[model samples]
Target: MLTLAISLLVAGAVSGILAGLFGIGGGAILVPVLVQALAIMEIDESIRMHLAIATSLGIVVPTSIRSFLAHRKHGAVDMALLKSWAFVLPLGAIFASAVAAVISGASLKWIFTGIATVVGIKMLLNRPGWIVASDLPAQPARSAYGLLIGFFSTLMGVGGGIMNNTFMMLHNQPIKRAVATSSGVGVLISIPAVIGLIVAGWQRPELPPLSLGYVNMMAVALIMPISILAAPVGARIAHAAPKRALEISFGIFLLVVAAQFGWTLLN
Candidate 1:
């Protein structure tokens, strides 16, 4: 128990920093780490991925809020974009979480692994000159894009930042604004994703102790406060760090995490 608490704290700290730094909602880091930690703690394999994803989303709620507030204070966030995405994003996230509940844990793991790899590679190869358009897509196209972001993000246990950042950058939005807006998307998706996970996994017999559906309450309790406190610090760092360096570093980290999950799946 003592070791578990310590591990959760360490993971939370890293996740919090990454949440603010990358606007990834920390799930990109938290999910795989939690899966390993929970497995070591003898959590049931059948529900480990689900529990990790749900609890990761729970942590994202507070972390993303802090990151968003920090970015908003800097006037980096785009309220218009947030407003446009608000409804559809959560709707998609909820639907994805519901779909995830019926899928096997191994399948979810593979999904996360695949998406993370793709996103990581994109980030690594991305150049500042890259542009698909000078502005975001309009109306139905925007809505479709937003839905895809929400669905895939929730499915992979991310906060939607990876996709949102890439999309915005492709549309010629500044990286800082993209990061800030992605933070808001994280908060929007997390709320519904968490609730959806709870509802989807309600009354499941295979869940670990102290779990509320797929979410492990103990993990949330141990990790949430630490992550929340650390997020602002990361947000500050994001502003200070060189944009390209940060993107490359984060991309490498994602690839490493994907490799870890892939290895686990193979074994």
Candidate 2:
């Protein structure tokens, strides 16, 4: 138990920094970190991923809120767009959590692996030409994009920043505004996803100790506060440093994580 606690503490610290550094939220890293730590506890394979995912979502709530608030002060968050998605985002996230309840853990890992690899490759390339459209689409199409981001963000235990940021930038949004508004998206999607995960995995026999459904509250307790503190540290570093090198480094890290999950799935 001491070892598990120690590992999660370190994960919390690092994940917070990663969230600020990448503006992609910590769940991208936290999920895998939790999976490895839980393995040390001999947690059953069937529920390990679900627990990790849920716990990460729990942690995401505070970090995303903090990020959103900080960014909103800059007057960069797209209020009109955010207001429009009031119902749409949570619906997508809840639907994803519901689906996760019925899917195999391995299936979740596969989805994570594939998406991580693609995102990693994109980061590594740092290409200026991967964008699809010039301007934001019409109403229904915009809603569709928002829905997909919320759905996949929950499925991957992320804060919706990764997909939403990229999507906005591709559609000719300014970089600062894209990042700022993505943080708001994170705030909107992650809260309901946490609740949905709890309901989805309620009373499951395979849950580990200290768990409430899929969420291990103990892990959330250990990881959340410290991570919240460390995010500003990462954001400071990002502001002071060369983003290209940082992007490449994080890109490599994501690929490595994807490889680890791949190996786990194969065995």
List lDDT for all candidates, in order: 0.88, 0.83
Q: Which regions of candidate 1 deviate over 4 angstroms?
A: 1-3
* TM-score for predicted model 1 compared with the true structure: 0.96
Q: Write the per-residue lDDT of candidate 1 for residues 133-215, one digit (tens) a residue.
A: 99999998998999999998888887898889899999999988898899999999998999999998898988878889888
Among these predicted structures, which one has the highest lDDT? 1
Question: Can you tell me which runs of candidate 2 are displaced by over 4 Å?
Answer: 1-4, 237-241
Q: Please give the distance, in angstroms, between residue 41's alpha carbon in candidate 1 and its true position after superposition.
A: 1.7
